[model samples]
Target: MMRHLDPTRLPTLHLSRGLVVAGLLGGVATASGIALTTTSGWLIVRADEQPQIMLLLTAIVAVRTFGLARPVFRYWERLRSHDVALRDLAERRTGTYAALVPLTPARLGARGRTDVLTGVVDDLTDVVEASVRVTVPAIAALVAGVGAAALTALVDPRVGLVLAAMLLATAVVAILADRLESRSQAAVLAARAEVARVVQLTTEQADELRVIGGTGSAHDWLRAAHVRLRASVARQSRGRSLSAAAVLVITGASTLACAALASTSGADAPVRALLVLAPVATGEALGVLTDATRALARARACARRLVELLGRTPAVVDHPEVEPPSRRPRGAWDPLRRTAHAERGTQGHPLRPHGTPRLELRDLAAGWLPGRTDLGPLDLTIEPGERVAITGPNGSGKSTLLAVLARHLDPTAGRYTVDDTDVTHAPLADVRRLVAVVDDEPHVLAGTLRANLALAAPDADDQVLVDSLRRAGLGTWLDGLEHGLDSRLGTGGLGISGGERTRLAIARAIASARPVVLLDEPVAHLDHPTAEVVIADLLQGAGERSVIMVTHHHVGLDRMDRVVTMQEGVPSHGQERVPG
Candidate 1:
């Protein structure tokens, strides 16, 4: 049940455990019931004279015990089977999420992540329910049916033959219906993915949809997807119903045939009469076949999806050759050490002045998808103790370039280096450790502010966090809040303003104290004065660390060490100047 175990291995374990438990409980219950029924029938037939009271009492007690144990065994089997199913589902859910971690925004887009979420949470629940409530019960029923038929064969071979034939016919019908249902379910899955895509599109375009009066179009798309899903469900339902009905009819006919055969054979005794009805018990067991078949089909489909997800290659692979810095400094170096250590300090050293450019990208071409380039194959570099501004119009690949430099996206062409080491081929974790990026749209987990900040640097002290927040202009905001850093941020921090969220994101980035930082329009949503203060703090606090700020506003450019203008798909011009 471990998350990292192979997907193909889980089902075998699940099945083995389920079968062993179910078989033990079911076999004992069936054997006891058959023995009681056979003994009672034989006693009544042989007792021509009045039977002894003790014999009657014994038979009654045996029958009562068998009847009581039936439900107990049934419940035990169901409980054990469910336990196995849930454990297997837990393993599948873990494996699916682990596989998705490295494929985000690439093999799996934002929309695809939503699909995976649905699959991991909702679809996985369905698979578990079907396995426990449907598959295992059906298996138990089949075993009971075969045992019943074999017991009857001991009494009357003709009756046993009829029951076996009926059971076989039902099995075949179940298999055919399962095929039909499988096809319908596959269609349903496709429709569900389409629905997810439409929902995501609608969410992303909520502002546009409200402005352009296109809400109805989104609704229509959703309606169409639902219709397709319903159609598939209807087809599956009809197939299963028909299969169940056929099974019922075959069972009834076999039972009736057994009765006629008993009557014609001149078995005039009550015991013999009861023997003829044994086929009815076997027939009843066939009723669960349809549910079993459907559950198996669903389980098979879920298994396939889980396998595919687990098999996907990670977008970024961290090589084992690279290692973290051995002696990371705690605070910025003195001015003399800063000058002497400029380029050499940028390579492996963690603590340097905040304003230095320790990371640089030159002629970089990168995108989420490999080989298909998006950003630039243009030259750019960041020097120690410098802040560089990157400007471009909307959709001009500003964010893409930042993501590339952050090592979230690998360059398709050209070179990107950190402290003179080519980063495109470097370990991803190493690149991440050297640089921290704060984007316009920040992700806030469902936890306290302190917890969220701690995610960036687990070992950061309270004073360090407070200092970073003050620098990001969030100190007053935190004081105004009820719990200060302990205040709980709801899911994605929904209650906070865009500006406040940006500040919190900045606080998180600064808390990391990396040598290189990337800010994507960090102050775009801030009010003028507050924006000015935060910008001043960012430029000042950057100290000797390298900083890249991507923005359209020209608020802090005059103070930057360099301003780089991006046009079309390349860096058109850059001016290196001293701060006024």
Candidate 2:
């Protein structure tokens, strides 16, 4: 199977028929510029010879025609080039997003995932921008330069030789500039990321830094980042400066050489003047080489980063030899064997799907890093509708265990199965669809309450949403809302308390109707009473679904069916148990 599902690759500045047409349009625009300059020179010298009115009429018309064609063709070039580039940009972004979905959260990194994602976006912009900046300009320069050389050769071969030499010198200058730019591109990108990281960290944690008396430390970080940024920019500028200066010098020398050669040749005064100005006009057309090479360097750097990111093997992959059986085996107890009251659902409300697939983990050792088992060489089983609480000290792998159980991290050793089949062969999406995760910092997006809940179940009706919110301990809150489901929450809208946020997340999970709900410190930010209330509501709300709560504190352990504690990577199940 392909590592990334998307077949379309990232867009690079490559030669294709669409690019050829765009380049041709750009060539016409650039050629018109050179023609305008040389034709004007011809008209000036010929007009000075006291020529007849009809003789000057064609020259004058030619000058006007070339001048007008320059801008018109240039505009057409811009339209064609931008259209092709933008279409490629859309395809690349879509393909990249699809490729990234399977590598999310775990394969991205252990931390700073937001930064990684932001970098991907910025890199993509640079890659697409290259089509306009580098490819078109480079092709335009080549077309115009070669046309000027060939036309001049027809008039005087010696002067044309001078133009060709100037082109060679310009090519050398471009090569130098490209080397310089490529050398500094990585440093510049690194400096930019560093500056962004420092700024983001300082702004997001300003209060904490101040409280810890580390404000000066944060400032030092920013200052150092800025220093690196300035250095990197200076390095990048050297290439452009060298290319620009070299182009001017080459143009001046070629003009002088053409003047010497053209004067000695037996050409007409008008033709001689045109040849002398040809070098200067070609130089102007090729001046964009400096900027073009710089863009190429930047695009190359971005493409490398993108390739490295998109090419990695996913953290988890499914290779199921056969489809998993639909029928679930009998666990320690039946998931459907709930109390009559629980069976009736919440206050005569209809029960959502009980996603109670049996889960078995045997000697499942896993970790974020290789050769470092943070979680288990342990065994556990979760029956349907089983509520289990996992409590552990920091670094004892409570969260790591949850990550493995949720299929975000693959086990390094032993076997994990849903129902009776090993998850290694199970389809990743199918397994993940049965699970919902609720963490401490639930994102309450800036939208209506209905929109927020609909993120979990887009096809769910309003009545089902209301029932979900009520079951997740938002019954009172929902009753008080004037607009009901349409009430907006999050930034720029109504702010919610920590408990409400936690409950909202639970509501989303409830709405998803996944059989397994993993809570990673869901009540970590709440006070004791609110935390207890949230836990009570969660246990009451979970209708015949497996609930696994990972907590640093034992606030709601008594409410769970079984409380398992982990110490130094070993799990010790407590005797305390409650009826389902």
Candidate 3:
């Protein structure tokens, strides 16, 4: 069962003191602009009376001061707000990534895992950016509007009432814009993700699609995705357009009202002129309302997605009452024969298993989703150091079973025990520590060869790395490298053939020295002969470790001690043992 989390409870959505201070600075900048407009109007009107030049000196200096203060305060506000937002972004990204690690490949959905990760990155950015785009402007507008109305009220009550009404109407318009933006942002986000997924799939599978005569259908999908994106964008624009039109209309009416009230009052000509220009200045300052509303809507949507993704319960749980396996010296179970150390553990000691553990599944059942069994209701067992092959077609549950064996998933029913200990009562890290997984597309990070292999056993020495590579049948390849372990392997470095890539994945497992290795279609992309050679090297390289290979092909089944054929969600046919 998955737990649902409230997105509003996330700490990232809250504003900090730094943001509030920046908003205050922004308000000062806006207030200066409004003051400049009214005072300049007064200076111009008073000059028409042909007064002495000395009478205008104070007004002239005040206008110049306001002009200079606006830009200075605005620059400071930008620096403060962006600095705060960027720091918060770093913290949020780190936290989100940590939360996602446990739910990978299972709770993240079967397909589109890459798209899910990409969306997380983009959404986190939007949530952080809202602090600057939405929060700062909203506070600035409130401060400036209130100050304008208060100052105007001291002059004449009627004109001040008109300005206050204008501010209230702008707030109403902002609310309407926010409602409209909220209604369309989700559609726009979905349309954009569809377009991206379509383009990426089409480009990456171009050759396969062409061979299977799916190119036309692929193009049709791309075209449909583009059409949806355009429609969503068109709908999203309505809110911005409405806010702009409403602001302009409201400003014109308010200016007329202020002018009428001022003209009938007993105030002088200069004072009346100043009163008329106040509404016009305030309208320009509030023009940022539309952009701020849009940011708020988009940020809310991004936050919702993040919460939904991170709140799901992990497929496997580590029971708090269960303690991790106690440490034992290498070869403790069979002291008659000394086993060579594999990976270095804490403080440079080896973390090798005492001996290989037996695995048994008794009518086990499991699924990626609730109420849908993808595997089992069958019995199976593997003795120490045995090699087995699970042969099945797609949807026959081979991969799901492997996920259970690797401790990446929890079984829904029945019992699974490792060396007579039930897996559910064992700590997750304890079971996972004994297993290594090698898949078809093993990621080759763009770095040095040593760095890539060190991901499995960070404390292993160069000699250990060389030994593992040699065992995987890469001794000749390593000798040819100019820099030995320092040789780079991924993009912009050295290119690897399909056979070499499979061997490298095997080498990583060998270096880790876990007691069991689960290979899920490790040679799915390789040709017949290449697949055979890779499998031979992998099995040989694993040494005494138990090996379980899941595949539909019969390329290397002849070497397995047992072969189990599965149908639907359980093993159906009698198992076969072939002579090695």
Candidate 4:
């Protein structure tokens, strides 16, 4: 029963000094309630007597003190507990985000990865919130129950024995309620996750679904998910309802027993009145245990889900030497970027073998999933200073090959070497540092224009950045910007056109100064003239640099030094280099 209530498996939990003070304050507050109830009872009985007001003074003062202390202590407890929980939540979120960096896109599902990541944040918050909801409340109830039993025993031992029996019964009810809640909690959590997934999928893919006439199917899916969520929540609430009813029944029965016992006692009337109210007060304090149990069940469910998701082995692993800090310097394009405006050469990438990196693929085989090979079992090579174009139909594994080349996917079999150094199993960080890839889909971060460009070349001065942009043909666009490099872009700022965004991505690739530049359909969205212009600018900007471009379009074939067409996963014919 206790195992189901623990949430220590959550990665982001941090225990702070405030948590202890909160629990102690909560317990003291509960004790104050019991004291207030017992003292009020004494005051009522004393007032009924034909006695002087002075005789009732102490009881009145005690009642007033307990009443005042209860709210004050409770307020302090709430403040402290929330402070600790929020701090723990912040730390946990930070650590979880850090841990997720390595597991991105590959281990995370290719579809709806954003939704899954967003849901993890909400789940982590619930687990952290349980410190206040479950732990502190249970501590308060225990303290109040113990204090009530002790006071009753001092007045009459049999009444204390009855109170203990009542507490035990309450514990039994709590355990039963927890079991019921736990049974439903997982179902509810899974339902909520499904709803989140469905909603995000519908929202993100609305256009695609509409184009394919899947709008009705998507609506049906979302509706079904919502229905299941509603049912799951209703089922979970039943346990809470049962818990509240049981607590009330126990309170009533215990109060009656306490009153009967007090009537038979030879103790003074005022003491007996105090004894009678003790059971009722204790029951009120224990009623909050239902909320504690619900919190425990919810937190446990969230933790269990996180445990399963986070436990998966990562798709990529770093080699031993580069596992801690990357072998390359932390700087962007470290050991690569040059002081000059050159995109590639000895001035760039000092680590490049003889100042030019050779990428060779010998029978490389890899896939998106296990047992499904999509690329290779064939050999290919990108020689130094070569400009190569690969043209293939859809599903010919062009993207998969690029994924392998970029170190986003590992080769399942065969050798992939860089400048004669076999890097099939090299640290991903080390391999990625030597290659620059610009795929069809580019991301524009929400930041200043300079901030967006700086990601690819952090140390690049304004002239270098401007030069790269000019080479990518963003020269006209730059001239129109009032803020120049400082212009805010993305959401509530300058909206970059598709052509401009494509040019911006090209500029980033040029500015990166990596030894090898691999472009995958860089002109996918451009018209023929724009495509020709962009491709011409690309070849001119990449003097002496190794460039491997994969494209389905045929607008700029003349500029490529060599062109190879592929069918299935293999090169259809011999690689053909254009006449000099």
User: How high is the CA lDDT of each candidate model?
Assistant: 0.69, 0.83, 0.85, 0.79
What is the C-alpha lDDT profile of model 4 across 374-434, one tens digit per residue?
A: 8777588988878888889998878777777777777889888886766644556667776
Instruction: Kindly list the per-residue Cα lDDT of model 3 for residues 294-352, writing each as its tens digit.
Output: 89899988888788888878888877776444544554452112233433432233234
Overall local distance difference test of candidate 4: 0.79
Q: List TM-score per model, in order.
A: 0.74, 0.79, 0.79, 0.74
RMSD of 4: 6.4
lDDT of 1 by residue, 1-580 (tens): 2857553443512456665676567655554555555555655664554667776676677767877877788678767776777777777667756666666545554445567767756656666666565656565666777777787787778887887888789878988988987887777777778888888778867878989999999899889988988888888788888888888788678868887877766655655656655655555555667777777677667666665665566656655564333432556332211231233232322354443435667767776666666678877767775687888787667778787777776777788776567775455665666677887668777898888899786877777777778777787887788877888897655378777777788777777777678899888766777777777877665455677899999878877878777776677666556566
* Over 4 Å off, model 2: 1-11, 44-55, 265-273, 323-354, 379-383, 386-391, 439-511, 521-545, 551-565, 571-580
Q: Which ten residues in a row have the lowest lDDT in candidate 4?
A: 1-10
Greater-lDDT candidate between 1 and 4: 4
- Residue 413's lDDT in candidate 3: 94
What candidate 1 gets wrong by more than 4 Å, as runs, is: 1-14, 26-67, 109-111, 120-135, 264-284, 306-310, 318-357, 368-371, 383-394, 435-567, 572-580
Model 2's alpha-carbon lDDT is 0.83
